[model samples]
Target: MNHSRAILTLAWREILRFLRQRNRVIGAVGQPVLFWLLFGAGLESTFRLGESGQSFRDYYFPGSFMLILLFTAIFTSISIIEDRKEGFLQSVLVSPVPRWGIVLGKVLGGTTLALLQGLLFLSFLFFTEMRPGLFEIGQLIFLAGIAAFGMTSLGFVLAWRLDSTQGFHAIMNLLLMPMWLLSGAFFPIPSLENGSFLLHWIMRCNPMSYAVSGVRQQMDGSFLTADLAADYWFPSLSLCWAVTILFSLLMFSWAWKTSSRRVQGDLR
Candidate 1:
């Protein structure tokens, strides 16, 4: 089998599957934009007084965009579970393509979906906010690309062992909510006076925190004007991206190896 050709074919199939379900694409991209347009604007009065003092629209717009990417990653993983349930995954496993290639294609396909949705969200944001220049637009797109890959990688890891869509949804909800909340996407971590030392520490350690901070800094107004060091923000997000990708590789490799071993054992 031509490995690259098989991967391209599989990835194309996945993209077409997503595209055919036009509602999924629309809902995936539209919800976040609607949230930022309605709820974020309504909350603008509240978030404006926080450390960054950004209008809620500006503050939530990027985070809202992040949520769109996040949801797309999680939702796309559901397709994997659905395939497994329908024996589609087993069929793919019997194909001539290498297991690693199959995994890579799925990850890339999902990342592409997430990035497309992010672009749509960012377009809305750009139209609504007048101050962001070409550089800021570029920066946001760059950040969104990194984040979609990171989140898709993470989702691919979580989907590796799941056999049912319900199981995937259960696990995703368990993992996703805390990650969103502790990440400081909604509001900046104020100070120890507001929480216990451990809670504060967890927020500091949350990878989503790094993603949000990197994105927030690139907004029309820097989310906070305290003059965050570029060194700090850039490295933190890079680390988050690295960590997400590393975990994904580890997970995919494990799944591929385990499945291959199972096949070999069955042959015996």
Candidate 2:
């Protein structure tokens, strides 16, 4: 294997597979947008942010955006399980290509898919009350890129050990669903002063919480306000950025290491 060439070919193969299966595009992006609409309609009257004065829709939009990236990541990374069963993974393992090349190829493919879907979701922002300007959109995409890589790496690591799609789904639901819900994506966490102590602490520890919080701050009227740090409800913007970056690095390292391990059914 010409190392870099093999990596590019594998990454392109993933992209081509995604493009051929158009339903994944809908399944990944449509489901989240639909859920956003339904949830916003149902919760708008009841779910107001304390001092921020943001509506339920405004609060949910960034989380929903995060959902788009996550859904795409999940959809993209699950292919690892499928590839293994089809014997493609075993074939690749027996090839001369380095494990890191394979990891990078898969991760890059997943990252691109998530970023594209996220950008698609961002397009619908014009229809909403919250407006992120060009520069803000750039910032949001930057954050989304980091988040997508981390999440795809996580999904990649999880899927690497599984043999069936059903098994992957079950594990992902058990892990990711709680990760999203408790991460302050579905509901706001009370400030430390007001004190929902345990709940607040969990959200504080969840890395996804920082991802959603960062997006929330960027979209929550910072464009119009003179103050950049308006909402004190969640973690600070800088802290969110730092945590998000750190989480991505950790997940990437894990996935790269996991790539070298012998998965079940690997050829001797």
Candidate 3:
């Protein structure tokens, strides 16, 4: 079969598997709602200004959507390990398709799945008054697609070395928590008291920090208008897209190298 056909067939099979077991899809779309509803409601009255003037709900809602994309991407990576265990990898290896195509197919399929969940969440948020504006809604969807790709690349790397579900989950959890917390997804990064060096470092180093910042800029209506003239802004959404694409490429390269090394038993 042609590489394109192979990828489409694999992607279709994965979508069908998701349909047959809709719980995973439902859960992926549901948790974000629960967060927006429960957590947003609880803190709606309390959370305060991070210089955006958006209320707690407004600020954190985008973060919740990011959370959904993050979770979906990493979980989808587990399919690599699953395929290996189920003999699916053997079938793919026998095919004429390149090994990179196998990884690319999985990433495309998984990221598409994540984007679907993201759209559903955005739709829910719009209808519920948790968010507003048709343009903003569309922008959110676009950003979600970007986030899904970034996450899928990260997942590819995680699964490349992880042999067991437990190990994958552990490394994923470790990576996920720090990335999420440090990215200003849950709380304001600049608001952190100048006492903790480690948190300050993590906040500076995490790339997710830029992503969350971008989403927050959109949510708070600060994209073109500078709230703080000194604070670095990407200058345009085009830059944001370029930055994300570049970052995703770097991640894919790293993950591909890791996978190749492991396949040759050059890495432990």
Candidate 4:
């Protein structure tokens, strides 16, 4: 098979599989929306930015959006585990398709789903006062695609080594959930100024932090604007963009490297 055609076939299969799984759709999309309503409502009263007059809901909008991408990626990555358990992956592994194509096929599928769902949630901006022109929204959506690629690759790396979805869920709970929390998504980085130096630096170093900040910067006009009145806590947009791209690249490199290995390659 043509390499590009094979890759797209694998990717399309992933999309069809996800669409057939109705529970996954509801769980992936609904969980984040619930989090937004519950967290946003409960915290909006207590959380306020300086004179920007930003509520926690507005500040958290991008984070919630990111969560939608994260959840979709998680759901999609589980396909690796499922394929292995069902012996589908072993058949693919024996085929002539390049290992890198398998990696890209899987990651690209998840990235496509994540980007689409993230963009759908981005439409929620209409409900809010965010006044971004088409170009700006396009830029944010592009950033989201990059972030989704990185995150799905991260899941691929994790799932490639495991045969059990439970194990994958445990690790994601231990790693990815905290990753989002510290990504400056749950709260402002400025709030950590007087807090733990270790934690402050952790968030500063987290690539997801840069991703969330980039979204906020893009949406700055109305929601979580980077006006001078607010503390300068986020990394510069240039830096965020750089880190976001680098994060996706690094995670993908790791995913590809791991896929080249044979140990624990499948449940059989």
Candidate 5:
């Protein structure tokens, strides 16, 4: 098969598999809404948005959207483990397709699912009192797609090496969950009085921090506000986009490398 055809075939299969699973749809789209309603409402009064006087729910809108993308990416990538066990992956490995095509197909499949769910979550913004202009809506779509691509690629890399879905879950909870929490999705980077310099450094190092920050910047156009932008400790919007794109490329390369190594080892 040609490279493009191989990629499309794999991606189409993933999309069909995802659509056939009703529970996956509910879990991907429903849980994020539940979390937003429950946690966001609970914290709205207690957690203020700096001096802007915005409620936590308004501030958390972007994060919740990111959560949808993250969850979808996680579940979609986990299918790799199942495919491996069922010998489907081995069949693909032995096919005439390039390893990069396989990686692109899988990553793009997960990314497509993530972006779809993330956009669905966007419809809830009206209830949250957020009405983005046409330009802002476009920006949200662009940023959401980029974030989903990078995150799904990251999950692909992890799932590519794993043998079990349970193991993927454990590692995801340990890695992805904390990455979200620290990405300023749930809370602002803590003040020095309430947090440590090390914690601040860690947040800066997290690539997802830029993803979250990029989404926030797109949604609110907060980059125009100098003081407000500085308060949150997120990178600049351009920086966020650059870092996120770099991250996506790096993760895609890593997954391709890992898959190539696996194919070589199997031949040996």
Candidate 6:
């Protein structure tokens, strides 16, 4: 089959598999909701957003949405390790499909799955009573899609070389979890008075920070504009988009190169 068809077929398989796994769906959606409610309520009184009086739940809505995407991307890409262990990935590698096609198919499959899960979390806006404009909602979804693609690609690259699922989980917990934590998802970049220069610099350097910022800026542009004196930190929307796009392309290229090496090693 042609590359485009191959990619779509692989992506469809991912979507079908996701639908069949009811537990995965429940965990992906449930965990974030629990966090949003438990933490949002626990901190609502104590966590203040300057003089604007926004509750912690209001501030955390975008972060909770991001957690959905993160979990979905991690879970979806873990299937690669399963496929490798089952010998399915090896069979695909030996097929006539180019290495890039294989990588693209798997990455796009995970990306699409992740994006869908993120969209599901968007429904919570109704509970929050947020009435963003249609254009704002569209922009938020577009940014979420790009962020999901980049995150899924990163997971794909990490899982590509691993032989065991346990190791993948460990690496993801150690790396990916921190990426989200430091991305300003749970809180604003901490002030220097409360955090060191190193901690501040790390958040500034994290690409996921831009992804979270992009989503938040798109969703809460007016609120953020009116609260200019607030201590919250986020890069400009243009810069966030640029960094997210560059990060996605970089991760995709790395995964493609890794897949090529795997094919070569298997053939030899």
lDDT for each residue of candidate 2 in 1-268, tens digit (9 for 90 to 100): 4698888888888889999999999999999899899998999898766544667787788888899888889878889988987888888888898888888889888988999998888877776778767787778789889988899989999988877889888987899988888877888665666657887788789999999988877775452232212332567788988999999989989998998888665752
Output the better candidate (3/5) by TM-score: 5
TM-score of each: 0.81, 0.92, 0.84, 0.94, 0.93, 0.93
Clashes, model 5: 0
Writing each residue's lDDT as its tens digit, candidate 3 over 189-255 gives 5423433666666675677766776666555454223443233222245555566667777877776
lDDT of 1 at 114: 87
Is 5 or 6 the stronger prediction by lDDT?
5
* 56-102: candidate 4 lDDT, tens digit per residue: 77778899999999989977999999998888999999899999999
Candidate 5 versus truth, CA RMSD in Å, comes to 2.3
Clashes, model 1 = 0
Best by lDDT: 4
lDDT against true structure, model 2? 0.83
Model 2 TM-score, all chains together? 0.92
Q: How accurate is candidate 1 locally (lDDT)?
A: 0.68
lDDT of 5 by residue, 143-224 (tens): 7887787788888888888887999999988999999998988876654545678888788888888888888878876423
Q: In candidate 3, which residue pairs clash? A: none
Candidate 1 TM-score, true structure as reference = 0.81
lDDT of 1 by residue, 173-254 (tens): 7988678766767655545555567766777777677666666656554444443332122234456446544544555566
**Least lDDT summed over 10 consecutive residues: which range in candidate 5?**
259-268
Query: Lowest-scoring 10 consecutive residues by lDDT in candidate 2?
Result: 223-232
lDDT of each: 0.68, 0.83, 0.69, 0.86, 0.83, 0.82
Worst 10 residues of 4 by lDDT: 223-232
- Pairs that clash in candidate 5: none
Index of the highest-TM-score prediction: 4
